[model samples]
Target: MAILVLSVLVLLLSLYFRLKKRQKNDGLNKFPEGPSHPLLGHLPLMTSTTDVIDVSMQLIRNHGKTVKIRIGPKILPMRTSLLTADSHLTEFILSGNKILKKTENYQFLKHWLRKGLLISDGDYWKRHRKILTPAFHLEVLKEFVQVFESVGDVLIEKLRRCEGTPSCDLHPFVTLCTLDVICETAMGTKMNVQSGKNSHYVQSVKKTCRIIIERSMSTLKLTDTTFWLCRDFYTLKNELKVLHDFTHNVINSKKNNKSIDKNTKRLAFLDLLLKFSQDENILSTDEIREEVDTFMFAGHDTTASGICFTLYCLADHPEVQKQALQEQKDLFGDEKNPVITYPDLQNMKYLEQVIKESCRLYPPVPIIGRYTTEDTEFDGCLIPKYTNIMLFIYGLHRDPDYFPEPEKFKPERFDNFDGSLSYTYIPFSAGSRSCIGQKFAMLEMKSIISKIVRHFEIKPTSPRHEVKLSAETVLKSLNGIKVTLKKRP
Candidate 1:
């Protein structure tokens, strides 16, 4: 009995010392320490989720642009990570295809997205990316512009209804419009989301995204088992069913369409997927659903955020809005039923700058996370392998060093913008893993904004000072982008 007690005591001592030695050797001791709890590490102290942006802002202000955060329990050291606003460091991490595996928080989304392109890594991601690349071809994208213009017209009509109302939240309206555009172009289905259709699917996607953010930040639901047991998980599971069923039905209904065999000029994203679905193990039904769902999820939400924020910025700055409208007039000339062609979109260079500046101010996908597959060194700091890496694109964009007068809404900044700086000005992100639909997203924004500017004069109900930001599904306005509209002559 005495020998047993002695052996247990030695084992406990060794474990304690081993963990201590490992932590010290990892050089985490040099990291800027966040508020720590005894057993909870930094989790208890962290204001995660949408408010995590505020928390990050504080951390950046207190401890330079680059700070380290240690979340979860001390016993599990994998939760410790480096949060950087350093462009050089961000470039080092994102530029590498080898370290492309997403951080652990993304795992929560796998419950819905499965091994979709956004969530998947390694050879699987490579294969899917290769297959999906043709779907974004210039010819394919130009075909998508027809959907964008039609959707934008519907959105303008929706705004016309609120012409007499005091002011309204623009996000929900804009979100529905983008949902319609993405579904039509990506899935080859006219959802009429702008006409108040697809509410259930829309609600489900939004709810699933909310649950994802909640699950990622909840310490109680750290592991998958714990998350699966929660009420949110069940709700999301049901919602995922609705989303999956909707996509699955659409995909199968069109799977064997005769058009899939032809080398047509009008190849929507799903057409490309359907073309390869019949080949040997190329893509199973579920695999097709994964990509469709991913495109649907990723394609709409981010673009909605971008579009809404750009409108908000324009409304807040009438001069900017006027400049954008003038640029549009120069090309379209108060034309009746002005269908913005691909070239028309390209000419709205000022509007493009406005979108870039707005995105820089309020980046839709504020932060990017990656897991270090190998030990990485940056700025003389060694980030241990398997540690969560956070690139604070939000903070980086707001940094005065890279962008002068970072708080100011200045679209003119992009007038002389240089594209060569891979690290800085990454609203759509940079690197091999940069957003796939960036060009599509840009054209879509230009399409909607130009239409709104020509058809109506948009004004902010509340000033920019009053509008607080919430980093929800995307960077959203807490008070919403409340705007008043007047029909233009």
Candidate 2:
């Protein structure tokens, strides 16, 4: 029976490749090709190695800014994607309305996130985007500054335990803090994840993120039917249940208690959704949960990763850290715990540059994907319709043409920076479909990092820890982001 199953798989693969060969003859091979196996294409090349980013970088180095990467056997609609680091091409894709549909790469999130803004396209995306736009407006995000301060206080207290230690991993501590921040800001419920209260929910989120990335990288687990055969399928099922249940309970609780806090006038993302649902009839309960869950997923991990990378950059570059700390001193005048306000966060121009430079080196979301709905002509090449376009943001940020000495951590490069670079420096992305929470993220990051610098002197480990980059859903280090923290005198 096993032998019969193996034979059937072999026959199917052979037939699939045969059809792929015929389809490729139909003038679809317009882009420059990379090294790939005829049958498996780039799937084996990408999955065979642990460092997917390195493989992608190597491909770009060998094939210039744009390289054709085939990952599967589908050919009529085409499973072959164009991997590009070109800013001009990126602008063409990101700035256009026709290529707004996200590629199948993001489909793994559907089971967890549903049709939230991150995955939804066309009219549904438009409606939800319109409805949710106000939640992250400057005014609404200003309300979140208090949340950032309170949550950042917890992070500082937690990191105090690691103070004076030889070395500590900052990723886990920062991740929990961001999770807590997102829980409070997105759901208006204090999760206290940093205080070690909601272990199950936190673990479920971590597990779900890991499982989704694992499934996305595996060719066999791309489809639901085949995914069921993998062990992670069951794990993902249980984790999603926990995540969905937690979000649903929060939504229900918020619905039951509709009284707004009179003192602070703080409205969470969930609160705004509920208001829209009641006042404007814009969102249903399930839709509310969908957007809430999307915020929870998108909000926490990306910011946490960004913060960790920035901290790592600061640790490695002491002069930059010293200058950043001096800027903090200038802002707060040696007040250990100064009340950080919106204007203060805006005044953190140098710290903002540090964050941008860190993001340039290690963008939380290293790559974004878009699908071409129709045959598109750009740079004299005709890309076939329904082709997946992988925008390699990491490679784009490091391109020498756009950024001279791109590998160095030089924050001052952003000094007096106009918008001359266009799409080349898009750490938060660009265009209409750009990150909605970008301003919130920037403010939160500025608030948290500023408080951290004011309270602690961060330094690199004695051996100099280096992060082994992994191209997960969010960029993570295989080795933890390690640094030593000393309480400022």
Candidate 3:
């Protein structure tokens, strides 16, 4: 009986695949020309995130508009429709039209993430966005200046401790600093991960990113089964349990106790979330935990990668470094006695432009993936239901058409700029599902950049400090971004 049931299920699945493949026949003519494969769709080379980004670029070069990729049977052909990054198609997708919804494969994230703003769609998305939007108001963000500055001070002190060392990996320090800031401001907890070199929370967060990267790269056909049996998922789950336990205990302690201290005020995200969670049907405990975890992970890592890259770019170009130093001096005086207040940070226009240019060159989230549901027509192509679309943010940013001299780093490009075409610049992504923590991220980046430039004279360590990238889900440097930071007089 068991054998019969297994065989029957496999046969049904095979039939479904055949039918789906047949429907894909007529769609290719309307879409951009992709490789012709016998059985597998154009997914043969697109197994990794890096490959996915590469293929998308290739399609843009070859097909010019929309590219249709067919996933083979083994791969389950997830996200077969790679959308064209043109003005019209991009605008169509980004506008909150009722016809299109967030692809269904985002459900994989839902298992761990729950219905947070990043993954939720439709009315659920709308309501949650409304409630969460107010939480990130401008005044509230401006208040976070102290928390950001405090973290910056600690980071400067840490770098001072390592002054005599030949060089240090700036990535880890930036990551730890941002982590400290997010934990204190977002959740009102004192993680102090930056203090201890080997904090469990820090390790757990790193491990979680690794797990997600692994899962994303897994063969799509086996993803459902593999996730069910995977040890990584279990490990991530356990880590989240630890985080939840920590969060709940903090919340419980703060619930009835009204003695507000300086420390309590410093706990930003947690306090806001806790206060909001008390409202009727506002958010579930599970939901609140997911948001906190999401912010903890997403909030810290993206900003860290951006800052790391900015430092690297400065090291690579000494002239730009000199200009930045001059700006720093002009803004806050000499390095020996530098102080960056909130208003000063706001006025550092040149520094802001540099950060933008760095992020443009090396976006933290280089590629974003979405799955299409139901047959759809985009850019004159018929996209079948359940097709996976890979949006190549890195490729789009580097396209010479949109950004002239795409390879060169020029902060001045944005100095006199009006906004470009929506599809042209997607460092933060677009649409209803764009990054919610963008403001927070900007504040964090500005503070870190101001502090680092003000205190240190950055120089390349080795003659060849190669900017190689490791493809964990996030583009991180495997060797670490090593640079020498000389203290300024």
Best by TM-score: 1
lDDT of 3: 0.73
Q: Estimate candidate 1's RMSD in Å.
A: 2.2
Ordered by lDDT, highest first, the candidates read 2, 1, 3
Using TM-score, rank the candidates from best to worst: 1, 2, 3
Tens digit per residue, CA lDDT, model 2, 201-253: 99999899888887777767878989999999999999999999999998898
What lDDT does model 2 reach? 0.88
Error of 1 at 348 (Å): 0.7
TM-score of 3: 0.87
lDDT of 1 by residue, 381-489 (tens): 7778888878888999998888889999998898887776658878777888888889999999989888888887888774433566766656777667778787888
Compared to the true structure, candidate 2 yields what TM-score?
0.93
Instruction: Estimate TM-scores for all models.
Output: 0.94, 0.93, 0.87
Cα-based lDDT for every prediction: 0.82, 0.88, 0.73
Best by lDDT: 2
Superposed model 2: Cα runs more than 4 Å off: 1-28, 48-50, 72-78, 261-264
lDDT value, residue 424 of candidate 3: 73
- For all candidates, the clash counts are 0, 0, 12
